[model samples]
Target: SEMMIMANWLMARFLSERNLPAIFRSQPDPKERLYNEDQGTLFQNWMQRRLLSRFVLSSRSERHSGLGLNAYLTATSPIRKYFDLVTQRQIRSAFDLDTPYTDREIERSLHSLEQPMFSVSRLQYQRKRYWLLKYLEERIGKKEEALVLNRRRNGYQVLLTEYLTECMLPVSSGVSMRSEDMIQVTIQHVNARKDTLSVYMA
Candidate 1:
């Protein structure tokens, strides 16, 4: 936890120092508050929009409602994120008094990047879930607990604390499960190849 906090603090400092337009990761819950009015009017509201987006790259604006920044872009890592590489090239060329790409080229890239990123995100999630399901498959019958994230009509969607994965719990105990409820549960069955899990409330 200390490492994470320090890493974020360092990144924020680095971005502020460069005065570069970079990507800012926002808070997950758009309605969640993180600050008091004493901090700033916008900061508190911005805290709520986290997890609502992936990487937001805008060469155009640095203002992230959540980051409370005047300008931002995503040029932090060239290899990890293609968007960062593109932004870095643009910044470097501008410093050398030149343009890196034509206006049409930039527009074309903007059009193509969305789908590729979305596909990659979906694949990454599926892959992780596949491995977790495999782990659960080996441990079936072990009693576990889950955090309620969403309540469905027939069941409830729960987040498994151990695996850090969410799956449906087949029983709801005849009540509307509230969010963040720590409900006792057990792993009934799991199929890794099929990427499926069957869970029940304890």
Candidate 2:
């Protein structure tokens, strides 16, 4: 992954310097920082993931803050992604082996891909989450150890240690819990189709 990022970053810069039109991936800076160092506890990393900004596609070059790159595109996985293939073609154009896509052509391609990409990503996440929830449903009534990730206004966000699945645990007004604290919780309900899960202190 590190090498792919480096290759993508260098290729993006190469295309940008030559005024080539390639589908560039850009990400804004995270809304906030949870930690500064590379090494952080699982809870800290989870918090930081929540703060990350979504990456966007563009015809022109822009900063990709998530990867700490001035410009970046995924040119290493041509078989797996459409934009990656487009980028690979752009790189070939730099070597006089292929015709480059015009800026308008890249923009049109991105516009056409927006919805299909979103649907595919959403379906992938929903399917994975559904199976995880189904697994929890079978183990309903069992006590599980969970780590408190954060305390919300109405409840606490906790992750089941065994499955690494997160669910909300509502507490009474007077109950106290802190982030990173471990607590026993009982799975009370789960409905994968509706994407619902409920838990309570055990």
Candidate 3:
């Protein structure tokens, strides 16, 4: 993972320095820090993940806060990702080994990809959630351990330790809970297609 990050970082710098047009991945700083190491290593990591910002792809290079880099792009995983292949081609073009793409061309390509990429991402997320919910259905009514991640207006956002899935657990008026609290919960209902999972304090 480290090597991949380094390679992508270097490739991004190389393309930017040469004024090449390529898809650069950029991410802003996280919203806020919710936990410190003193709280608990696991809890801190989870909170950090929760606070992370979403990454975006563009023709212009920009800082990637998640990777703590001034600029970054993904040139690896060509077979697994279309943007990687496009970035690799840009690098090859830099070395006079392939055709070069103009900034306008890259921008148009990104625009064309937006819908397809969003659709694929949404499908993958829904499919994974469906399977996970199906797995949980078998354990409905069973007690499971959960970690409170955040307190919402009407409920608490919790991580189901056994499955690593997050769900909202509504509490009655006057009920109180704190972040990072570990509590037992009973899975009351689950619907994979509807993407609903109901749980309550056990």
Candidate 4:
């Protein structure tokens, strides 16, 4: 949690310093989501839209994770992320290490890397969602307690308080809910192929 608090502050500082429209890639709280990690995939869809600068964030309690740090670069996931690969090349260049890819060469690759990286990320997301859906299918009819994270147009989105899961529940036309409200929800439906989960208020 302390790491996340520090990371979040660093992210805030970086954004404030540059005034850039930014992308924050955050995962679930390490205290919890570190186990299942789907919370990390919470905003897979939003991160891909046409955006300004890209940066990483981690460890937020809500769906969006934020671990604030002044600067972060990926040096892992060579197959799934080009930026990490580029970072690796940059590190090599810093050590006066000879390689086919130079700092300048990697610098020139960023423009082309964005779209492809996004595609790779989306594919991996779909794969994970598939497995999660399958897991949900097995647990159908079970009731779980969740925290109200946000109230949306149709209803509310809740994060499972005990399990590493989340889902949306539609409100009766005039009903309302507030953030942080504790609610009970039943795992009602799951479609693995479509990556859809249906939950009903209990």
Q: What is the C-alpha RMSD of each candidate to the true structure, in Å?
A: 6.2, 2.4, 2.7, 10.2
Predictions in order: lDDT: 0.62, 0.90, 0.90, 0.57
Candidates 2 and 4 compared: the better one by lDDT is: 2
Candidate 1 error regions (>4 Å): 1-56, 65-70, 172-179
Which sections of candidate 2 miss by over 4 Å?
Answer: 152-154, 161-164
TM-score on alpha carbons, each prediction: 0.66, 0.84, 0.83, 0.57
Candidate with the greatest TM-score versus the true structure: 2
Model 4 is weakest, by summed lDDT over 10 consecutive residues, at: 44-53
**Tens digits of lDDT, candidate 1, 56-82:** 643334345555544444444679987
Cα misplacement distance, residue 116 of candidate 3 (Å): 1.8
lDDT of 2: 0.90
Q: Candidate 1 versus the native: TM-score?
A: 0.66
In model 3, which runs have C-alpha deviations exceeding 4 angstroms? 35-51, 150-154, 172-175
